[model samples]
Target: MKIATKKIAACAILALATGLFYQESARAAIPIQQWKASNGAQVYLVESHAIPMVDVQIDFDAGGRRDPADKAGLASVTAAQASSGVAARGAEPGLDENALGEAWADLGASFGGSAGSDRMSFGLRSLSEPGLLAKAAQLAARQLGEPAFPEAMWLRDRERMAASIRQANTRPSTLAGRAYAAAVYGSHPYGFEVTEATLARISVNDMKALHRSLVEPCRAKISIVGDVTRAQAQTLVNTLLSRLRLTVPARCAPLPPVAEVAPLAAADLRNIPFESAQAHVLMGQPGYKRTDPDFFALTVGNYILGGGGFVSRLSSEVREKRGLSYSVYSYFSPGLHAGAFTVGLQTRPDQARQAVEVVRQVIQTFVAGGPTDAELQAAKDNLIGGFALRIDSNRKLLDNVANIAWNKLPLDYLDSWTQQVEKVTVADIKAAFRAKLQPEKMVTVILGATP
Candidate 1:
């Protein structure tokens, strides 16, 4: 996901200039109301009377990471079907899966689902009118519990995914991303993509079996935010969750522990057989999880390194100094286990190697001598001051809360994040990098380049 830096920089500068800004001081602690439904489903509720809408997200432990070895796309295929209309013929009848999605989108009631490495998420957003809420909640429940992955629908989606994989072969950006994931994760499930072979291999029975095994109430977390009271939230949770039978599956196996391997001395080059003028270069190594202690430090440090555009070392070096690319960035994608820490940029095919070298050098310089006190302070100030903006809206709060729930983070994490960032001294920054990011161990992939 790309960071919209134009708004970020404008806000960050204002935050930096203001020596002391205390938005949260007067605001009471973000009250997180929690309860268990009769069906053993845990519900997390945050009542925000600020907006006249409600957003509900239900997450199950059944994500794509658990897709069986033989049926690599089963989990994702199942997830997509879940948001499509149910097989039941009720007030909404004869609406096929794809039609249901389009219909919901047309009606202004947003519904969708994604299968990530660790969990499957199904959510709905709509106005909080009691009628709308009830309809939305009922629709969500039906989709969650009774999706029929019709042969026609399955074939269409599978064909689409397969086409994407084929197209990816010719896309340099896609090539670099795929290589980077494979290099960092090796043969781990996280490295696997939705291939035509995988899609063709997935049967309807595979999706049904996976759904039966994984989408259980006990292994789920529910988040309700916006114009909903405790009672309204409880009703919604119970209505949707009570139908779900709570049967916890056996715990997933732990990630095969991965250690950084030596970096490539010669760049790994792939010919996607495309004629794009720009080359996509992605470089980095294994990343940390969400709850890692060094998260706050790495977050702020990365901002200066590349996460903060225009103000970042990468932007200065790659764009301002040499005009190698329009934009460049480095980011840590935190997942259930370790995600990727990737630095990516698109430059003319001729200049891709130079751009990669610049990124590597910048990282090396930081590893040897961490960010200056001034840079560290700027990051800290920006993070702390901008905390309010992050949580200003109910949707934003729901996202943060969902992340906390999915990652099993402390309830008061947002409250404590600022303090942790403030405590990250330069020594701490250096130490964190030394432990987590290895400059020499990063695997570099330059796509759309000559061998």
Candidate 2:
């Protein structure tokens, strides 16, 4: 959404938060209306007439982190099955995932989303036509509250997923990822990835057990964006929510302790020997959580360091200048807990060790010195300049809203995004990086010949 005009006092204040200096008749709105449903589900609604479509996303704290140590993929499986309607045993006759999808298609709508480290997210996108919202809402309510976990679909999905994991085990990149997660997270739930063995042990009943504990109203966040008015959105939410059997706990269950919380104070390295066409290198240590104040700094700084692609320091040093590899990049993954700041690349086996060393050197120097003023300004410019595109589409806005609600970020977060990036000074980036990153105690994973 373009910055709106400041003539209206409220719009003006919101515009100012965007750090936009131009004089406009109106400013974009972030009037997020929030309320808790009878079942204790948190709902956030943003009305936008920019499109005639409505987007709905509901997230539960039912991601991998909620998966038991022995049943690492249950949360994901449950969410997936719920969305597809395949595991929703009590659904209407002939309403498998495919049939549900066909019904939605008839109504000019789509249904999908993903499970992640901290959330099992699902979405519904449809024209704001007369009956679409009610129908979509009904389906979502049943799937969320009363899934049956159909055995046939579960067996099929489990077998398919197990085979995929088995195949991924043969890929160097996949092995490196598994190794990296294990090395960095230690015993943290984030470290757990489903293995063939783990998948085999997860029965259909196990999924239902995990599903019962994690998919509760006490742990749900709902975000709606599009052409609907706030009143209309509320009606839709309230009706759909009435079906849930919420039992709010006295206190949210605490996450298990992370075996390692400190960013590496010394290098933790692992090398897996495998015959590959090219060496895969991965490096980084613990990074920030989604709510970390320094998140903006880390995000902007990472652009100049490696997140900015060819213009970034890592690319400039490792690929453009030295011609070591065609590509290299880095990112700070903000999750339910502290995430990893991973840097990755691939190069010829002969140059694998040197490439890893060069990457480390680049990180060491950048962490020590930070980005140049020019680099910092450019990153901010690019990031701020491209901010509008982040929510240009209905789906995109829905995604951002879901993230904000799921993370409990301020509703004005998107409105102030540009200003936050603009206010990030070189000092902020440097200081934040130095404090958050530890090059000395990083984990490095390389899949190739180790000499």
Candidate 3:
């Protein structure tokens, strides 16, 4: 039975990876159907009958930002343990982790939970055949609402995670990233590190309390893509959330607001000694939030700066001309609050200083003068040309729909995405960068570098 279950799970994964489940159309315009569920959950759907599979993602406000200072990994652990087991309900017997795994394998479907900086999400992927889909949704609903939070499993997983953390500590990149986050984010929860001590403070009771408080049906944003119509998607969502124990509120109350990420008041520099062959360097400061008006400008500007691979100015100056590092990159991680804008690279300990200097000069120049006409045109062209690949699959399209639901973006956001990119001018890029990034006030961390 175990061998058969393993074979079934492997075949399911293979089918997903090989595109045996869905097909993509060349149509650029994706019309999103948006409505509120009877449970007060926001529903976004992109119906595609080209294939017989459906992908659904439900997101809530429960994420790392809500973690208590002492229990830094609470949200992450809660999401992970949701599928460890489902408690027995009436005559229905409880399913242990092993039993749950076998059940999903038997159905050739997948469902799981994950938490990020801003949201906790549960996703489901199953064939849209009525019988198979109904069974998969029922199982997922049970796992979502009835987690047992078994103490033994928590203890076992905690030890494994601690061991992994110890291994990660030996890596220079990990040390550099940890130090950089602390320096950049200061006391923000975004900088909270999951230490063994923090994990020790997280009890099963805490997980249960968090799940009960935040996983209310009224707070969900459900995004669905694939071979389901509006009526069918509504039914799937209703089943998936039916097991939630909390009553639907008269009106969903807003969660307590988290403090915004504090901007850097002054530059922070850290140098740590290690015996590694290469030095890890990270630099940057707080960036804009997801809803910031400068998002489009920043997105285009970043491509020309460091996000466009070999075509970026950072690559041209730091790697190609100077030969200081094999790869150097920069990015902005915008979330509910301001996220970090980071520039990162690795090089010989001696060349680390030179690489850092080159990166700084390139950023300063770009922010002050902006991209030239040729650079601006190239970035727009690349972004617009490659936009189709962004929604070329069911999973990717589902993610975009989820983003729209979460961020309260317009229904036509995807349709106008290219137009937004095309209209961003050099002046727009310069002004946006100047407004958001502060090179002088940035945090810089260098580990395993020479004195």
Candidate 4:
């Protein structure tokens, strides 16, 4: 199974600038109205009169992790097909991609979807003009409730996807990422990227079957945000959510725990020699789940380590002090299961070993002794000061709300985020880093020119 991610290097660059300029003030605390629909789907709503718009998202536990062992990229295909068109059914007809786009555009609304590690998401955004919200909601409801997965488009999409995968083989950074995942997690679903063979096995029938189990109401959590009132929000949710399959699937089992492959006892460095001027290097190992107790500490510590780019320890050593590489960075990507804490850099082939040595030293030093008082203070101030931009827009707020509800995080998660970062002391940073990062057990993969 492949959990395909669309990577964004920087979460938000001009967030602070935009907030300060546009005055995206912190509105009232997000009063998320929580309840269940008559069909058993979880529902959350936050009413805001800040803007004349609305954002709605429906989430399902139908991500790459749930794909069959034989069909690796099935989850991604299923979600992708939903946005391109509405397939034809027995009595109901279908809408082509152009028709769908025109329909939304005519209403000044937009609809889209994505599949990830633990969930697939479909959302709608529209102006809160008279009748526009309901019309847009109905359009989203129809797409989710009745995806056709039409035959003509299937062949096109499959070929396009397969070609994309084949193209990734020639890129060293892509190769290193795929190899590193496989090495660290072993046979876990998180261990693999989508392969061409797996793509070949996926058919239109496979997607429809996956959709049956996925599009059921019981598997859904709906989030609504905007100028709508409680009555409007409830009605809107009911209209949108009631379109899902009413009965639960008979074999819906709870998800299993993240596979625990014991960290390596010695260095696990792999070199894939190819003709190249520079080497792509990646190192680190299994990290933490999204709801881990030490989340705050790890988050702040990572900023000081490599996540802050120019200001980070890795940048200071690898770029400032020695000029061994163009850039160096690290991050902890927490998902539904144990995600990786990865550090990556690109450097000349001859200096690859030196780059690796310096990164390891930084990790060992940070683990043996935590960040300084100045480093900790700076991290906290940056995180705390930048907190407003996270919730500055309705779209951003909608995303955070969806995360809290779907991940079973505290409703107060966003509200308490700054305070949590504020409480992460130096000891907390050291303990969390030592526990989570397996520096000695780190799996290092390098792609460079062969002698």
Identify the leading candidate in terms of lDDT. Answer: 3
Residue-level lDDT tens digits of model 2 in 1-451: 0112112223423433453331111236467788876566788987876435677887877788767788787777777776546332443554676777666555555566578888888777665655656766766666666666677887888889988987988889899999999888887888898987777787778867766776666666889987798788877776655555557552346545434344555787888899888999999988988889998999999999999999999999999989889999999998868899999999998898899889999999998988899998999999988877676555666778888888889888888988899999889988999998888889999889556
- Cα lDDT, all candidates: 0.74, 0.77, 0.89, 0.80
Clashes of each: 0, 11, 0, 0
lDDT of 3 by residue, 12-76 (tens): 54654554333333245788999887788889999988666789999999999999989999999
Tens digit per residue, CA lDDT, model 1, 304-353: 89998888888999999999999999999877667888898888888878
Best by TM-score: 3
Clashing pairs in 3: none
> Per-prediction TM-score, please?
0.84, 0.88, 0.96, 0.91
Q: Is candidate 2 or candidate 3 better by TM-score?
A: 3
Write down the worst ten-residue block by lDDT for model 2.
1-10
The TM-score between candidate 4 and the true structure equals 0.91
